[model samples]
Target: MSQDLLFQLNGVSKSFVKGKEEISIFSDLNLTIERGDFVAIMGPSGSGKTTLLNMLGGVDQPSGGEVSFDGARVDNLSESALTRWRAHNIGFIFQFYNLMPMLNAARNVELPLLLTKLSKAQRRKNVETALALVGLSDRAKHMPSEMSGGQQQRVAIARAIVSDPKLLLCDEPTGDLDRTTADEILEMLQLLNRDHGKTIVMVTHDPAAAKYANRTLHLDKGKFVQRELVA
Candidate 1:
């Protein structure tokens, strides 16, 4: 692995036991993502895009080889250790806006702080700043049902970034939205990547959405087949 790489997967492989058969998703896969890179992984259904993202985010372990992050071997960490490490270093954005139905926007964004040692004032400040960053400051008190789908997704984005994690993994971030709403969310994510220098890895099937990334990696049959750098 190069010294400057933020993520390195060398000869990585993943498999699952289904019934009486062992299904292999990836074999001898290798990849590297540098700091501040906004990369999109595009693949057809069943191509293991989400699985790869989960592995990179420390949500799942590779069956063979190594997955390292910032010089640390994350694939070897214990489940409890990996959970703590991920909470501190990784932010995950899913297709569905996974917000607490009972919590308001601000309180939802503050959920991650419960794992931290920050005081109440500090947590509140962080939540406020994150909401403002996503342009949802005015909706801080709104419940999930009170907002549009786009607005709720923005709140989810705010919650993801409130802890200021080093890496952001997004899986189909705009999947549930209409074109216009999806475009707005993409623009916000691009701003976060370019302006704030957050390292982002997004998995999407939409070419238009992938255009926002600095590079698009095409995966076929669980292997990276091609890569395109877009200006």
Candidate 2:
């Protein structure tokens, strides 16, 4: 393993069983991601883009081969171990801001820290820092309904980064926002990758959203068909 490498998938394959048939998503797939890299994955509905992101984050496992992170094998981890590993190492962002409707921005951002042994004060401080980073410090006390879509997404981003995870797996992160708001969210993701050294893998169908990433990959027929240097 190279010191700079963050994630590696070698000979990975995934399949699911339907009513009476088996569907293969990917076969013998391979990929590598390095530290501090911002990568965008673009593909059609059934190209397995979201599956790839899920596997990378330990939300799903390959049927064969291996998934490794920082030189450690992740596919072989037990359920409980994988849960712990994911909580500590992976942050996820979804198309719809998945913030708890009842929780305020600060509480939503502090959710990740609750899994750790940090004191309440420490957790509060971490939440404050994350909210400030996402320019939501003043809105920390606001409920999800009180914020706009862009502001809610900002809260989601803060929640994702609050744990200081090694990897951020984003699935259509800006798909729910307007063009201007989407650009703002993408810019914040770029800032996190460039300034905070966070490795991000985002799945987006929009080329404009992919443009925010340094590298863009196109997946089709269970394979990566093209690669572009967008940044």
Highest TM-score: which candidate?
A: 2
* Local accuracy of candidate 1 as per-residue lDDT tens digits, 76-184: 9999999999999998888988989999999999998889999999999999999999999999999999999899999989988999998999999999999999999
Q: Rate the local accuracy (lDDT) of all candidates.
A: 0.93, 0.95
Worst 10 residues of 2 by lDDT: 221-230
Counting clashing residue pairs in each candidate, in order, gives 0, 0
What are the runs in model 1 whose C-alpha is more than 4 Å off? 1-3
Q: In candidate 2, what are the lDDT values of residues 154-227, reduced to their tens digit?
A: 99999999999999999999999999999999999999999999999999999999999999989997899988
| Model 1 Cα shift for residue 145 (angstroms) | 0.8
Colliding residue pairs in candidate 1: none
Which stretch of 10 consecutive residues in model 1 shows the poorest summed lDDT?
1-10
Q: How close is candidate 2 to the true structure, as a TM-score?
A: 0.98
